[model samples]
Target: MVRKCSVAGCNNTAGLHSFPADLKIRRQWLHALGLEDREFPPRAGVCKLHFTRDCFSNAMQVEMGFSSQLMLKSDAVPYANVTPPARTPRPQRRPGASTSSACIQLPLSRDVSCQTDPLETHTVGTQLSLKTLLPHFRSEGVQANVSCKDFGVGMSNADPLGLSSTPVKRPRLDLDEQLEDDALEHSSLEEALKGQDSTHDPASLDSSLKSADSSTPTHNSKKYIVYESCIMELFNVCPVCTRACDVRTQRLGTFLSVKQWCPRCTFTRHWNSQPVIGSVPSGNLHLSAAVYLSGASFILIEKVFKAMKLQLFRYETFQRHARAFIEPAVIHHWKATQDVNLQSLSQEEKVIVGGDMRADSPAHSAKYGSYATMDLRTNTVVDIQLVQSNEVGGSCHMEKEGLKRSLALLESRGINLDCIVTDRHPQVQKFLRERNITHYYDVWHMAKGISKKLEAISKQKDCEKLKKWMKSIINHIYWTAASSTSEPERIAKWTTILNHVRDVHTHEDPLYPKCEHVIRKTTDKSKWLQADTLAFYKLEKLLTKKRTLKDVAKLSPHHQTSSLEAFRAVILRFAPKNVVFPFIGMLCRLYLAAMHYNENVDRPLAETEEGVPLFKISFPKSRKEECRVKPQKTQPTFGYVADTMDLIFEKVFVNPVPYTDALLAIPVPEDLSP
Candidate 1:
């Protein structure tokens, strides 16, 4: 029969056993400390009130080293004289039936109210004897802490109770299955919103999202050929040919949509891709464009393309279409605007033109070869020719042919002719002499030559004398005037050094006469004429940047080839890092990439993409300064055609003779002679 609980507001049944007064009060106290799960000995148990209140002191004593069996016989044992109740047999359930069961059972020694057992000390007899009332309270309040809907640990499907049905199964997948799944999901989304408003079309929205993604790479190739052709044919092309609204797939609000774009024009919002078959090219299959782009050596350029959500296609159909219709039209347009001026310019500019060749070092240095030219006066490169030079002489021939072509172009236009300068490269000099091109030795080159000689001298037995003699000669040449009026004094300075060295040591050469003449002469025509003292200072400045002589020598070639150095920096900033294929198209792309060097593309203020220029900024050095007498605008003075001509033009050595002009008729510095 049920008996009401003596505790206030606790009307639940007392069931078979009831705790007496003191034990009930002690049980209440232990329940507050959450140690109410323990039960007293059966013969010593109290009624329900005393069982819940006073049982904790006995449980605490057991926890404090009193054994349960000993506590059963101790003074804390209630109803020590009463006989223990006989235990009931546990019910058995079928295994399969248990699987479907939604039951949460806390251990007999666990508390229902306290979720956390900071000490795990909940006992059976302390709070209310669960063991004594097991038949009555077994299912009641047992699942109170757990929820029915919780998908507990390891479970893949939701459980009716707050526990796992079974260990969660990892979805087993094959490569094909994974791909198909992705494709199905993507296509399903595309199909769902297919007929929505054009403004909210799924494909159009998807394209816009892709454009947003593609803004980071140094270069982006959204529409290789077919798409561009379709755009031009379908929609009127931009006059500037900068911007086009080509929609690519992007998702917004769970719909695939398109975004119209123009690379030349700035737009505030994304346009929808017209899925009308022609928006993209017909018979053009989309392959992994991302894979092809990843193969590029220029990391930034690849990233830029990726950012634009563009893909490259090497399809035969696209290539044929580009060749048949697009290329011809583009070429025609380019020719028509070939003379258009794209750069700002000023009059009577002080331009310093420099050129250097970069060829793979013996096929052993493992380096790509190219020739580049820069205007030091403005720090802007005007030419970069990528011609292969390999172990096979074919590459060399190609390089020579390329150089010849460039020289011809430059000669066609009057550029870099006033006071050209270069290092003492025999091949370059040979090329220059044949063309009657007036040039000078870079002052830095001359100083380095002197410095190298001095360093060698310092290693000799007669080092001090030789070093002093070398210094005097360098100072005399460096400080000497270029005018013919100072020729006699220059000759006297030359003679003094030569005589001193001859008297102190003996050295012989068959070309002594030619050498002596070089020693005696003071001509601006010599390739090794000392330039401004400032040039020597710059060389020294560069030398001091390094620690050892080897480092100085190793880096010295780059110093001489400063044009190539500048070009390398610009290229690195924009080009791919790994470029294995030497295709002409890629070369053209490289040219475009170089053209975009240092240009800042326009971007919105809340820029989500990094490394994209919000607006274009021209190369700073493109323009010349205003002359003292005549004021002029700052920009490229010559139009694009003329600029191109200036870069490739070399009046010297358009045609080479075998014997006469190819010889070194030029003299060397006074110190090097004899």
Candidate 2:
């Protein structure tokens, strides 16, 4: 007999007590009936159907040091009127009955289909309650005291159902015992299949299965490196001669290469690109590329190699690489400028040109002098000529024939220069004047020469006050040329400085007759400028000096070679006075520098919406009264080199061999040495 369920509509037996011991599984039964608490004194229980699947899972929940008591669900109808069957006691077994005793002590594992509570921690059996049989279960070495903590969480991996977590005591196996156990297992399986499978022998089948198991290996999932299968062979044909097939090779730096070759060739003419001992290129080892890329000084590169125990090439090799790679990169950029700046030649039928020359060193002795001619409208070098030794056969003139050569080259290119501005080099002035072309002395150069003279005068004890006006005098030379329209006006504005420095503000010319800048109305002692003083008389004599008058009379009204000076500085970086090279090598370096300088000569350093180039004010620290120096915008080198490298790799570089002058079609420079 069984007690009826406490659930309102359920008539099944109350197998489970609807345990709400920890309230994990009790919420559903409580919510279904609107109740606060439940008590089990009345044995108000319900069947397992009311519990969720989670409550019936194999994992058992046991609170430490506490028994799990259960009570009926509130929604369960009262079963107080029903009576459960009376509990029965088991009959005692006979003494010395080992088999029957063992049966009674063993733990039973049963599924939930038997209407038993699978959630119960105790094992179930037929004819007795597990709690009453606990003593007998312990006699068989079953772990009655062990709880969930004793079994540990990993118990489920070994036995998911956790029905047999106890460690049973057993005798250790000897060699004979091991053989007996294995024979017993095999015999039992053979006996069952003994009467079946009459066509096959078990012994032969067993041997075949053993062999298959031994041959097949299990695979595991993991990441690993896979080496290449084999080296590629040119094969069948010999490397020295296509007629022969057999050849011997040796390994070189992980790759295969020919050790010996036929007498016809000098070096090893045969090699395999593949490695005999396979490996991958793992890191950056391009020393030459890294040297230029990081902008590290060559000495520092050598030091780094020494520190890292890496092999550094000879110093000449680094220089050769510079000529090989960087020089061409710069030339490529220059040629691009030539194409894009073609509009520069469209400014006039014959554009105003400014010519200048740079020597290896400024002295009596020089190995080379490079003259560059620039079109005034476009601030870019039209062409350059390199003169070795003394220019123009060591002629008795302060001029470089390199200019004449460069100008001639430009004329052949259909570029006609209307007028040229340069310092009064005797031959340069004579050459232009003889051609009947207008020649204007570069105003800045004239001003520099005058300032040098003024600086010497300012150093005199009585003329120390003239130092303050040195900058003004230099400024006045530029101001006069910039302010005057005619050559006569240029002379008038320039000569006015003698009267102006003596406090004579008024002038003869209509354009700049009166001083434009505000005058100081102070009565300081140094401000007491008078024409009768020694400083004034000395400055007057220097201002009206023969060289000064000659330069000012032909002052360039609106042109100067200030841009060329900036380009020469770039050339100095590329060619560098401290380094020496062959004559052709020197010229190529100059071409590289010219291309780089011309590319961004007019680009605004930082611009506004109006697109005018910006100016920066700088005070010269060296010169107590230095002339104003104009600023050139910095050209960005980022990506410029990379683009040039692409041009070299794609268009210029044909092979691993060094570049040749014959390939580029460059003419050798003339030797002017006596």
Candidate 3:
């Protein structure tokens, strides 16, 4: 088999020869070739590159200088010039002989003696002068490996038998070792530099090299592990002051559930608390802002945070903790705002108050309903209450109990009401009467009631024109209320509709006897105002009802709950009906809506670049199948609800309450507790 050359980095193998049979000499030659601690295959040998011109015995070793085509002999050796260490064996003795009868071999004392008596003038080998011997050694071109650091003045001056000029012989490097180091040698003409004696064992050299090769991965593996993901030890030591422990804590850890502190400095920081790649998202406040405040779905939060490489608990955990943290705080803030709203209310003696209830679903089958009272003067939610069928002795309905509680909350807050406007729900009227609070019907509600009657009448063949006059009648009711202030003036203005519907805009009312708005000459008001007698009688029929007349008696255009309706719209966005929330969650969401509305209620919803008000066309949805679609322009406002929610989190959740609840029981969800 053609194995790679044992010499370091040398691949040539032609005419290879087994290295020194003595292991120590073999390692010395290997070290001289600069292949120290290199592992080679079994019985590996040197190529001819290490030998001089006269050392090889074959044409192949002489020509290609390698044993690439031939297997090396196991007993073959290099370095014919260097002699092995020589020692004579001990003479054998008979086992039975004691010292008295023992046979011992003895030799003449002069036979192997190197020492000659000082008085002797001649020696057996023939005494040679130093001058004669020194010339022979100098002409031999011998070299020895002598390093300068170990050289001393005695080495330069001292010579045995006065042979100071004699050349020293260096042990021959194996052909393999010389070629292995040949690349390191500058050129073929350059003599090899002598190397220090190698104490390394050829038998154990493989293990040491293997260990060195493996050490890199071992050290890197100690610092980090690669399983499903990388786990690096990080940030365990306190950066502020860890010098005393730095020797031991040279590498801080980066991983989950890690809270570290310096014993000496008391500096501390924390990592994941759940011992996983993902845990509570302690540092990302923006998640709360987007999820709870901005009404972003939790699934979206998960996708987004995961994309950003933010380690976070699952959305389910977020759902639990977020609701728990935000609900109570929102309620607390909602109550606090009541105080502020009431303080602002102190300036007015009698504030126009409008209370309305918005169900989670429509009125028939609502799981939850929130009733809120707003200050018409300030357009702020003063108080609100949420209810379910189970609450308040199982009323099995939303508006009655919810409105009662909302009113009771406002009353407890010492809010004074001038008049209340609401839909013509029988329960609401009864609630108002029981409390002896003044009640004015919502004009839109009354107008809706009149329009329902008009739809009934317009279906009759005699009252077909009532469909055209129907819009005029609705507009007339609001116009009359806005155009007149007191009961009699409102009465007189509303009565003018009988003549005005028959094309008599010139009326009997003192405050509004004639049309208050401009009358165009291109088209006569009389032409459009000339109401059919049948339509006139039809409108008059519905308009003359006692409830209808009573609503006009307390006409309050300013008391219309459009702002409350706007609040309801905002609440729908926050607590969307399709998404059922727990009782506390629903209430808190409502509170969040109320807080957002109150803060920016006065600001126009939209403005042009020139600061002029901009508006959107919105048509009212009505019960009439073929009603005129009169789209009205309404200004828009900036939604700062999410931004405000961020503030609430920073201020309120910064030091959160241990528990969050109001009248309802708020249970900690199982996921969050874990």
lDDT (C-alpha, whole model) for all candidates = 0.34, 0.51, 0.51
Those runs of model 2 whose alpha carbons end farther than 4 Å from true positions after fitting are: 1-300, 315-347, 395-399, 508-521, 606-622, 625-635, 638-640, 655-665, 669-674
Pick by TM-score: 1 or 2, better one: 2
Stronger candidate by TM-score (2 vs 3): 3
Mind giving the per-residue lDDT tens digits that candidate 2 earns over 1-674? 46766666678773555435556445555555444455333455656555532233221211110112222333333232233422224446546433332121221333242233323242110111223322233222121222221111111122222123342122111111111123332353222112122233322322221111133211111212222122223332323223333333332111222212222111112222221100110011124434543344567668876786443455654565556555555555655566555455744587888888887876856677788888777787877777766435543332457767866666665665777888778888778777787888888777777788888887887888888887778888888888878877777788888877777789877756888778777566575357787888888888787777777878888779988888898887667787775675677667666666665666657665697766676676546565565654755553544565444443333332333443255555566543
lDDT by residue (tens digit), candidate 3, 164-230: 2433232111122222122332232122211111222223222211112233211112222222122
| Candidate 1: worst-modelled 10 consecutive residues by lDDT | 148-157
RMSD in angstroms, candidate 2?
A: 28.5
TM-score of 1: 0.33
Q: Count the backbone clashes (under 3 Å) in each candidate.
A: 102, 3, 22
Off by over 4 Å in 1: 1-352, 360-368, 390-402, 413-416, 462-564, 572-581, 585-674
- Candidate 3 structure lDDT: 0.51
- Model 1 has an lDDT value of 0.34
